[model samples]
Target: MKLAVVGGGSTYTPELIDGFARLRDTLPVEELVLVDPAAERLELVGGLARRIFARQGHGGRIVTTSDLDAGIEGADAVLLQLRVGGQAAREQDETWPLECGCVGQETTGAGGLAKALRTVPVVLDIAERVRRTNPGAWIIDFTNPVGIVTRALLEAGHKAVGLCNVAIGFQRKFAGMLGVAPVDVHLDHVGLNHLTWETGVRLGGPEDENVLPKLLAEHGDAVAADLRMPRDVLDRLGVVPSYYLRYYYAHDEVVREQRTKPSRAAEVAEMERELLKMYGDPELAEKPALLGKRGGAYYSEAAVDLAASLLGAGGSPYQVVNTYNKGTLPFLPDDAVIEVQAAVGKSGPHPLPVPSVDPLYAGLMANVTAYEDLALQAALHGGRDRVFRALLAHPLVGQYAYADALTDQLIAHNREHLAWA
Candidate 1:
């Protein structure tokens, strides 16, 4: 199989290569292409990718290109990991929201909405080119604002499925806590991407043998600590919320904390410099330990499994993925993209039946779903009013004054990318 990574110049690519090398049997890649615009970073990342494959004794050849079409042409699958604007833009996304007293994040809050606007058009163009070259190829998107991006891909009629490491990360953690293999643990992970909850963690796949209560009883502090939420909140909610929720449940506190710390984008920018330096080294054969702190933990395994499953290279029947709601939540529109455990195979992911959602989670999910609708509207057909409306609908920026201020800041920061503005 030929597989293409659209943002292979990224420092994160080697970690993906590590997974591809280790799970070589699962994906059976014969030609791997790394596509990116940054030639210097591409060479560095490409060299390291080849070394990683060779060190793992894999036969697949690694190719690097700045030409998106050339890199993706005839590939069996294309993974979209591109950042439309690099960390410089992300720095702006992470910084200016503090001016409005809202959480500034790359994949949540106003920043995530900014990412969605910048991303959807670029991704659609690539998807169209991929379709022209390899109509049968599956597009596995690992982009931020995945819910919005995946929705755009599907709406534009691309053969695509959004992937993220968050679910796999949770499964790995829950398994470690339960003293079981990661494969043996199944999470009832549901909601939009980045805004999800682990309603259940089952020992058996797709079975209702929930051990979440046991986990909470024995490791409440640990679980709560991981989420950076108080143990009492978990006890009250009876389910684990994604760390992103902190921006909602403790908005003012998070904004205050963010104001005190250097932007994560700045930290990651520095980390990327160190990583690129390492990638340029001829002797470094394995993914560096420092890469772990850069985020997207377990991304490789998640990407490989999702890609393989979509291509009918079957293993586990159930994997958590971002796909249509299809009435899984009942409260949200069927077309809304949600991340949930699904039976993935050749036909694509069929979301497993979800338990009835509690009002607390469902209500917020519905609200966000509405906000995402407007967010995409603003993305597709750019207008200040639409952007303002989306921000107003967002639970994080519900007030008119904040929405007005955020809309102006978002547009100002993103004007270069927004053609209509």
Candidate 2:
């Protein structure tokens, strides 16, 4: 199949290429198209692709182009991996809104709003191209601010899927912490892009049908006690928490008192800076994966899994997916595009009904709704009312003096960006 990797110049590009090559035997790739605006990045990814193709003795055609039109033409699938902005953009996504005393984390607060504003236009432009070029291709989005991007694509009437590994990754960690195998663990989870909660988890098997929650509730304390500082806290969160989630949830009083304080965002930024310094040196860019090691295992396996499902290589069960709510979320507006269980096939993604969300869960969805609406407003209309509405709806922000002050502060600090008076 012909696969297109957008943002081909990204740091993760090599790993993705390595991932595809590793699976070439089972799922041979016939063509790869690399798309990016940066000449240097295109060259970097192209170089890696050549090496992989040579090493694997694969006969696939690798095409590199700066033109979206050329890159997307006749593609069977596309991996949307572009960052709206890189690390610099991420820093802004985290820092700008916080400067105004509003939650400033990327994919959650005002930062996500800004990201959606910038990204929506770019994403729409790509979607338009894809519609004209590869009309039938499955667009796999690995972009950040995923919820918003997916919404934008859906609004524009395109075929797309947002893929996140965090769900399965952290769930497995939680299972390990609880002394159960990953496959045996079952969890009910819901939340916006990065902010999610595990309503409950259980072990599901012939012998363990009723033992899942019991294991967690009974052994949770000891499991929490045994893990290192942050991981232990993550254990108490019910599911193994992601490194990114800790930044937001850890600061909450309940989370902190529970001894699951999150690592600071500033620390994450500094670590990123260090990595940039290392990669700035051309010497390190040429390193190879260790012998016998799978390259880009994190995403490649998922990509292969997606390919298998799309092609019906195996009679795999339908995969759950996130799509427009229609009625998936009874608590929220039917128009809301919720991430719920779904099954995918050649016909594309179909949403599964989400069971009722109780008060606590409903309240969380309400908060997310405001955040999502604010982003949509920013992306579509660039309005202050939309932004204000989002913040006011946040559980963190209330309809009192503090909320007003936060609004004024944000508007005053970033007048250029803030559309609200």
Candidate 3:
């Protein structure tokens, strides 16, 4: 099948390639199209994809293009992974609000809303082009403010599903924290990207009932077992967990400690810069790592892995993403593309409906819904007040009027970026 990766020039392209490479035998990718605005980066990913396929002794057509239309034409699946304004824009997204005495984080709070407002228009353009070019193609979107962009794509009447490695990665990590096999620990995951929580987790066996809360009661052991443990997420879900919780729950405590608060967003930008420098001249670098890793990398085995899984080359269940929750989950407005667990095959992705989230995470769901509504309003209407109301409704901004002031200030300060003052 023809699978096209839009924004294939991104630094994360390698990880995706790595992810798919390991699945090549099952997915048996027939053709791969890498689309991006940067010709050099597109060439890099395309070159990597071709090399990975050959190393595995698989023959697949790999094509790179700057033309979006050319890449989407007759595609069976399209992966959207673009950064509309790049890290520079994200830096602005984070820094601009900080300058106005507001919390500055991309894909959350005021900064995330601003980022969404700016990005949705651009993402929709890509979706529109894909729709016009390949009516049957399913768009696998991985853009930040994913909840916003995915909803916009669906609202604009496009076939698309949002994707994020964060959620599933965290799910598996939490399972590890609980000392259970990842597959055996079934969870009820909900909420928006990055802000989501696992409301329930249980051992898949017969001893399922009450295991999650019992495990959570042993917080000390869980924390010691995994420093990366997201105890806060667990606490929120009222269970044991790992990952973003280390920072998310400690936000207030970290500030009290006078230490550098954990910021994956800042780290993401810095790593991108370092990797771009390394990729600029692989000869000067010791080992190259893409995504969050540093150095010692192969051409990447991920893309092939995905291809293998798609072609049905495995016995175990493969994690392939399919869009679910369009009509089922009322928490998110209809058309918000939610990335959930799915089994992939020749028939494509079949989504798994996780259990409903808790009331705490339900608040986050409400925030994403607000962001989605605001993104749509920003796209279809030019009302800054509407955007303001959305921001006001956000949990982050609920107690911080400064966030609102910052939002207003940002629009005035960066009128060109917001397309209004």
Candidate 4:
């Protein structure tokens, strides 16, 4: 099967390439296309991709191009990982929200809404192009603000599924702590993208015994340390919240911490420079160790598994993915996209049934879902009012004064990306 990566020039591409090379048995790709408008970065990443494939003894041919239509034409699956405004825009996204005394994250709060607005239109255009070229192709989105982007794709009637490394990352972490293979550790992962919780850690299968209590009992401190949360919080909730929850559970503290540190985008920008320099080394046949620090850990594995299942190849039957709720959570609207464990196949993901959610988590999920709905509206039909309303609705930026100031800052920093601005 042929596959296309729209943002193949990204520093994250090597990790993905490494996965495609290592997991060829899972997703046997014949022609792999790297599509990016940044010709220089694309060339560097493309060269490394080919070397990784060859070093791994994979027989697939790798191609690179700037033409979106030509690159995705006739591909069985297309993965979206593009950043509409690059790291420069991301720096703004991660910094300006701090001016409002709020979290400056790329995937949530005011910054996330900015990313959603900038990303949705570009992704929609790409999806339309893909639809025109290969109507049967599955769009696997790995872009940030995935819930909003995937919702845009699905609403526009594209064949799509959103992938995040959070669930896989947790599975791997839990497996290492449990002395089991990652596949054997099934997470009862539920909630919206980036705002999820591991309600249960099952073994064998979804219906298998839940070992979450055992894990907490034994490794609560370690888990809490990893999440940067208090151990007692986990003990009280009896569930592991994704790291993103820190922005909510400790909003003021996180904002203070963020204010003290350089924006993640700035750090990533410097890292990308070093990574690109490393990618240029003809002798570098494998993904560099420094790339590990660049994040998106285990993304390759998740992408491979998702693509394989979507292509009707052998892969894990159940995996965590962002797709329509379809009543998996009674609290969420059926059309709202949610991240959860699902049985994935050629048709797409069908989220597994979840038990009644504790109001503690369900309330937050419902609140964010409503914010996301408004965020999507702002993204689709851009206006100062829509943007302000979305920011006002966010749990993190609920105050009108903060929302008003942040809305103007978001548009100001992202005027070039926002067509309406």
Candidate 5:
């Protein structure tokens, strides 16, 4: 099968290459194309990719190019990992929100809104081109604000599925803690992307016994520590919340911490510099250990599994993915994209049935779904009012003053990206 990576020049690409090399039997890619506008970075990353593949004795052909159309032409699958304005824009997204006493995160609040607006247009154009070049190709989006981006693709009538590493990361960690293989542990992971909860941890299959209570009783402290939340909070909630939920559960405290530290974007920028330097070395045949600290842990494995299943190759039958709700949650609209466990195959992901959601988490999910709805509107048809309305609706920025201030800052920082600005 031919597979194309749209942002293969990124420092994160080698980790993906490592997975592709290791899991060749899962998604036997015949021709792999790396598409990026940055010629220098593409060459550096592409060279390392080939070396990694050769080191693992995979026979796939590796190609690199700046032309998106040419790179994806006739490919069976196109993966979208592009960043519209690069890390410079991300820096702005991570810092400006703190000015409003809000969390400066890349996938939530004002920062996420800015990213959605900048990213949606570019991704749509790419999807349109992919449709024209290869109508049968599947689009796997690993882009930030995945819920919004995936919704855009599906609404535009393209075959797409959203992938994230959160569920896989959780599964691996839980398995190591439980002294079991990763495949034997199944998570009842549900909610929207980045805003999800592990309602249950089952063994063997979706209908198997739930071991979540045992895990909490024995390892709640460690889980809480990893999430930077108090152990008592987990006890009170009776469920494990994703680290992203910390932004909501402790908004003011998170804002204070964010204000004191350098933005994550800045730290990642420095890490990318070092990672690119490491990628240039001819002797480096494996992904560097430093890449682990660069984040997106287990992203490659998640991508490979999702891509393989979508292309009718072998992959895990049930996995967590972002797809249409279709009444899985009575509270959410049918078209709302949610992250949940699903039976994945060539047709697409069919989200497994979920138990009734507690009012607390369901309320928040409904609220954010509304915010996402407005965010998509602002992205598709740009205007100052729509942006302001979306910000006002967000649970993080519900106040009129903060929404007004954030809207101005978002527009000012992103004027070059927003054609209507």
Candidate 6:
């Protein structure tokens, strides 16, 4: 099968290449193209990707190109991993929102809306190009603001699925704790992308066995440590919230913490510089250890499984993915994109039915879903009012005063990325 990575210049490419090398039997990528506008980084990254494949004795041809049209033409699948404005824009996204007492995050508050507005337009343009090249090709999006981007793609009628490593990462962690394979750990993971909770941690499928309570009873401290939450919170909720929930569950404290630290983007920028330098070393054949600190752990595994299943490569029948709700949550609009367990096949992901959620979780999910609606609107039709409304709808930036200030700050910091600005 052929695969194209639109942002293959990314340092994260080697991790992906490493997975491709190790799991050659699973996906059998025949031709891999790394597409990027930044030619210099692409060269370094492409070199490392080649080295990775050669070191593993994998014979797949690795191609690099600055031309998007030629790179994705006739590919079986196209993976979107591009960052619209790079780390500089992300730094602004992580810092400006904090001035309004909102969570200074790249994907959770006013910052997330800013990212959506900048990203959606570019992604749509790319998706349109992909359709022109090969209308039947599947689009696997790993871009940030995934729910919004995936929604944009689906609304435009593209065959797309959003992938995030969160669920798979959790499964791997839980598996290690249970001394089982990652595939054997099934999760009743529900809610929107980045904003989700593990309501059930089962062995095998949903009908197999529920070990959530047992996990909490014995490994609560370890699990709590991973989430950076307290054990009591896990015990109280009978569920584990994704780390992104920390922005909501502890807004004030998070804001205070963010105020004191350097922006994550800044740290990542420096790390990328080091990674690119490492990629230039001809002797370096494996993914560097420093890459783990860059986050998005186990992303390649998730991508491979999703792609293999979607391409009918014969993988698992079910996995966690970001797709339309289709009444899975009952409360969310059927068109609204949600991340949850889904049955996968050549036709694409069919979201599994999500069980009833507690009022505590349901209320937040509903609130966020409404905000996502407005966020998508602002992203599709750029205007100050749409931006203001979306921010006001967010639980974290509900106050009119904060919303007004955040809207302006978000626009000012992202003027270049926002065409309407």
TM-score of each prediction: 0.99, 0.77, 0.78, 0.99, 0.99, 0.99
**310 Cα displacement, candidate 4 (Å):** 0.8
Show model 3 residue runs off by greater than 4 Å: 174-181, 202-237, 240-270, 280-287, 294-357, 399-404, 412-421
**TM-score of decoy 4:** 0.99
Clashes of 1: 0
Candidate 5 collision pairs: none
Encode model 3's per-residue lDDT on 373-418: one tens digit a residue. Answer: 7656865565667767777666555544764686576576446656
Q: Write the per-residue lDDT of candidate 6 for residues 96-143, one digit (tens) a residue.
A: 888777888888898888889999999999999999999999999999
Give the lowest summed-lDDT range of ten residues in model 4: 325-334
Instruction: Name the candidate, 1 or 5, with the larger TM-score value.
Output: 5
Show where candidate 4 strays beyond 4 Å.
Answer: none
Cand. 4 Cα-lDDT: 0.95
Candidate 6 regions with alpha-carbon error over 4 angstroms: none
Please list the residue runs of candidate 2 whose C-alpha ends up more than 4 Å from where it truly belongs after superposition. Answer: 25-27, 56-59, 174-187, 200-211, 214-249, 252-297, 314-320, 353-355, 397-421
Q: After superposition, how far is residue 362 of candidate 3 from its true place, in Å?
A: 2.6
Each model's total of backbone clashes: 0, 7, 40, 0, 0, 0
Ranking by lDDT: 5, 4, 6, 1, 2, 3
Location of the lowest summed lDDT over 10 successive residues in candidate 1: 308-317
Model 6 TM-score is: 0.99
